[model samples]
Target: MKKEKEIKPPIITDIQAIFDRARQAAIRSVDFERVMMYWQIGRRIIEEEQGGEQRAIYGERLIPYISEQLMPTLGSIFSTRNLIYIRQFYRTFPIANALRSQLSWTHYRSLSAISSIEKREFYLSETIKNNWTARQMERQINSHLFERLLSSTDKETLLSVARNEKQPADPKDIVKDPMILEFLGLKPESSYYEKDLETALITHLQEFMLELGNGYSFVARQKRIHLDGDDFFIDLVFYNRLLQCFVIVELKTHKLTHQDIGQLQMYVNYYDRIEKLPHEMPTVGILLCLEKNDTVVKFSLPENANIFASKYQLYLPTADQLQSELQKELSKQNVQ
Candidate 1:
């Protein structure tokens, strides 16, 4: 009998891979060069309109005229607002070398909204170094992450804290108490089914994930697990890259109890044993409940337990409430 002929796999040469990479690099270089040219042109236009004087009247009118003239030639990219942004961009980052190549023009536009030069520079450096996407950048800014960190630590310490490779050293660093879920649309006193809550959370999943903390990416919602002929469904599961562990979140609309903690612990144990990589950290369990007994939580879990319980809010907490709670916590810590 004749043997079947073997099919050969297509060859991928190293030279071809190098050439492809070179082409991509060249495209990016050209695009960035164009952006830089536009920025410089905007700067020059602003300068000339000022008649080499900072207080010239033409400064106010020049952008509109230039935009009108250039719109047809430059297409939609040369809108008045975009041209103004380019001018602002040049003013914000005077040195081309200071501009981050990794960030797109849109990223620079967002950074330009920040008024403080030092704060803007810090955000720009962190965003570039951390490879934060535009959405992440916005979330960080909206959360007032820089100010929050600064309030708690010095600048050098804050940078170290922000860039630390380890999981958060303190509970305050990782947990956002009274998480905002305004998208749920259900009042705190209103009755809602588990499905309704889950649906709402899914609808506002991005905001939820941001509130959850850094490194958390959604894995599944209402994820079902079966073992020993029994069925168990976890409300939510997220993988935290920084912690290198599975973060299991259980949602409860009522007050938390010891049983709820136990159930979450079991789920965390399951993930730690079965799903976690060999080098990964222990799985963390968070119970997002309407109410939590701090005393019960302190006693229920081992001193070093990775499990946590945080309260959630339907709307943003009043500023006074947050301040009062923070002051209380600080007082207690100081006493301790």
Candidate 2:
């Protein structure tokens, strides 16, 4: 008899990819179930506490007693602190139907910690739209991203865009000034070259893009442009899908200068005239420097120029620091 043909399994990672995806979906389902369970627990706790009264009866001790009772069977997840969080979660989002299954318990916990309704809603919408992890949401909240954006754009427009009601109309709607790059691992006091900064940004490109806000994708780095026998290399190039434009970023390890602005402007002009498609919007230039003289930037560029100078911080600013800076900017705008 002829020898039976031998069969070998296919060599490909697609099977691994499928398994990874299934695992992710399963994890997400389990997380959502945990969220729902916590919500139900919160509701039940609230009902028992209220007992038809405006305030909970012995509210101070009730959580501890319940935690002591549940800990034996339910594990430490029902500890007093967590039980309090669970209770607050329901109060924050009273309507069970309003809870998004896409958000896990951790996400809801971070969101419920927010005191402002509008801020919470903005973060919720953005988390779902951007598919941000719980850690990312926490970072945004910690960085006062909502307040920072509000300083640049109107409240209604900012919220509407986050909610997908409308697209961002201007770069200011998305781009953040004083971008917190604490993730770059660069010390503010240490001296570094522009090339060093650029390399660091490239290394942490994912985090950098998140700092850039929405609708951006990396295009090129050190993009060479030849004009009239002169060769110019742009530091970094990105495309913003929402703005339909090329974003040219020029890194300055020192304070910005008028010449730096001029250089970025030339790059923006070149991209607009030479590389931009007919359907594309005008190119935008961003000067990411350690410091900027807003007065100089104002005078250097044309009134309608799609150019902006933004300061970059090696460390995250405190809430008070951000608020103070925002107030100063608002004051300048008001004066202008």
lDDT winner: 2
Write model 2 residue lDDT over 145-216, tens digit each, in one string: 776565544556655565467878977666667788898999878989999999999999988987887789
Q: What clash pairs does model 2 have?
A: none
Each prediction's total of clashing residue pairs, residues at least 3 apart in sequence or on different chains, is 0, 0
TM-score of each: 0.59, 0.61
Highest-scoring model, TM-score: 2
- Distance from true location, Cα of 127 in model 1, Å: 6.4
Ten consecutive residues with minimal summed lDDT in candidate 1? 149-158
RMSD, one per candidate, in order = 8.4, 10.7
Worst 10 residues of 2 by lDDT: 52-61
Cα lDDT, all candidates: 0.76, 0.86
Residue 200 error, candidate 1, Å = 2.6
Tally clashing residue pairs in candidate 1.
0
